[model samples]
Target: MEDSNGSGRGPTVQDVAARAGVSISAVSRAFTPGASISKKTKERVFDAANALGYTPNLVARSLATHRSGIVGLVMGDIRNPYYPEVVDALSRRLATHGFRTMLTTVWGDITVDDVAPSLVQSRVDGAIIASIADADRLGELLYKNGAAVMLFNRSAATSDKLSSVRCENVEGGRSVANYLLDKGFSRLAYIAGVEHIYTTQEREAGFVGRLMERGVQLFAREHGDYTYKGGFDAALRLATADTRPEAIFCANDITAIGAIDGVRAAGLRVPEDISIVGFDDIELASWPPYGLTTVRQDKAALIESCVDVLVEQIRSGQRTRHIQLVPVSIVERTSVR
Candidate 1:
C-alpha cells in the first residue's frame, strides 16, 4: 500500500491508520458517531488525523447510511436586506444542531416547478422554502418524495402539508394606519409592492380596513413593485399632483427610504411636510439619515421556529404541520409624526 494519501490527495483510511499505528478498522471506528472503540485508541487516531489535517468524507459515510445530513434551503430575493438576515440566522442555528444547509435560489416569486428539481436531485432530507404559494403541484411533489418542508416568512396557505413561520403583516398595517390617523393626518396614500405577494395583500387590506373604520379614504394609490425605483417614481407622481397626500404608507422600508428621497427631491421635508411610514425594521431603516418609522419582525425568532420544525421532522421522521404566525411591533422614529 502507498505510504499515505495526504491533504490535497484526500486523507484516505490507509493514511490515517499508517500515521496512528492502528488497523484500518480502528480509524473507521474512531470517525463513526457511536461505534465501540477504546478511549486510548480513539485519541491516537484523532491525534493522527489532526496532524495529517484529515477531514472525514461525509459522502462515503452518507452512502453507508443512505441519508445525507443536509437540509435544503430554497430562497430568493437576496436583494432584499430582510431575506439575508433570515438566511444568516437559519444558517447559524442549523449549524448548532449538527445539520448542514444547502441553498437553492429562486428568482422573483417562487414556484414549485422552478425549485423542486434542484432540491429533489440534491436529496435533501428536508427543505425550507422562504417564499411559497398555495399548496400547489410543487408542494405535492415534495411531499410524495418524503421530504419534509418548512415555509419561511409566508402565510398559512399550504399549512395542511407543511410547517410555516411568518409575521403578522395585516396587524402591522393596521397599527401604522392608526398611528397616522392619531397623529391627525387626513390626506394619505398607499404605495403597494408586487400585487400577488401575500405580504403586500394582507398589509394593504389591514391598512384600508382600518382607514374605512375611521371614515377616511386614501387620497391616491401607486404600485411600487416592492422596489426602490418604483417607490421613487411613485412619490414623484404623488408630489407633482395638484393635491399631494400629507402622508404615505409604504409596503417595505426600502421603498419608504426611496419615497423619502423622492419627496425631498420634490421640495418637501419628511414628517415636516409629508410623513412616511414603512414595514420591516431593517438595519438601514434606523440610519440617522433615514430614521424610518416601521414595523419590526424578529428574524432570530422566525429562524428558530422554522429550524425547530424542520429539524424535528428530519431527525425523527415525525410530521409537524404547524403554521406559526409571529407578531410584529411598530418602531417609532423621525420618519413619522
Candidate 2:
C-alpha cells in the first residue's frame, strides 16, 4: 500500500478502503444512502473512516447523486432569542432526517444575489430564508437553481406565486392592541424593530389597525434595529415626550426588555404609570424581570413544519409550494393587566 502525504494530508476515501481491505466501490456503497452494501462491510468501512478522519465529501456526493444532504439557513441576527430557538429546533429536526444545517446571518449587509453562491458552494440541498417579501426574485432564482427553498416568519413569493408559511401577523397585532385597550391604556406608542423587516411592519400595522378600532391613536413611533439598545434608546425618546405614552408595545422581547430599562430610568412604574407589551413570548419574556404579555408564535411547530417541507422537497425533487400559517396567541403576564 502506498502512503500519500503523512505530512498533514488528511486521509481520503481510498485510505479508508485500503484500511478496511475493501474495494473502492464497496466503501462508496457503504456511505452512500440507499446503496446496497453488506452490514459487515458497512461496519468495517465506517470504523476505518472514523479512525482516519475520512468524513464523506458532501459536495462530491451531490455531484454524483445530485442531492446534497445539507440545508442552508439564511437568517438575520441570531442575537434575538426567538431565532436561536428556531435554529436549534430546526437543526435537531433536520439531523433526525439525515440533513445537516449550514447557518448564515446576512446581518442586512449583503444582497440576495450574494447569498446563493455561498449556499451553492456549500451544496445545500435546500434553503430556509427568514426575510421579507422584497427578495422575491432572489428566492425564485434559488428555487430555479435546484435547491428547495422555504421562507420562515417572513413571507416570500414562491414558484407558485404564494407564500410559504404565512404566520398570522395581523391577528397577533390585533391581540396585542386589544390587550392594551382592555387594560385601559389611552396614550400609546410603538417601538418598532428594523423598519424594513416584515415582522415589524406586520405587527405595527396590525397593532395600529386594532388600536384605531378602539378610537385610540399612537402618540409616537420610533425605530429599533431589533436590538436591546435600539429599544432602550427608542424607549427613552417615547417616555420623555411632552405627553408620554402610558403604554408602549415593542415588536419583540429584546426590545421590550430594553424598553423596561428606558421606562424605569425615566422614573415611571411598570403597569402603573406605563404598561408594556411585546411579541414573540421568548424565554426571556417569562423571566421575573420581564413577565411580558406577548404573542406566542409556536416556534417548535414552525421549525418542524419548515424542516418537514424542505426534506420532502429534497427527497421527492418536487416543491411543496404551500403557505402554512401557524396560529399566534396572546399570553398575559405582569406587564399588562
TM-score of each: 0.85, 0.84
In candidate 1, what residue range of length 10 has the lowest lDDT sum? 1-10
Global lDDT of model 1: 0.81
Question: Residue 97 deviation, candidate 1, in Å?
Answer: 1.7
How would you encode candidate 2's per-residue C-alpha lDDT over 38-118 as one tens digit per residue? 889999999998888788886787788877778888777888888888888888998877677898777656666667678
> Model 2 segments beyond 4 Å from truth?
1-54, 132-134, 157-163
On a 0 to 1 TM-score scale, where does candidate 1 land against the true structure?
0.85
RMSD of 1: 3.9
Worst 10 residues of 2 by lDDT: 157-166
- Residue pairs in steric clash, candidate 1? none
- Write the residue-wise lDDT of candidate 1 on 175-204 in tens digits: 988999999999999999777677888999
Alpha-carbon deviation at 198 in model 2, angstroms: 1.1
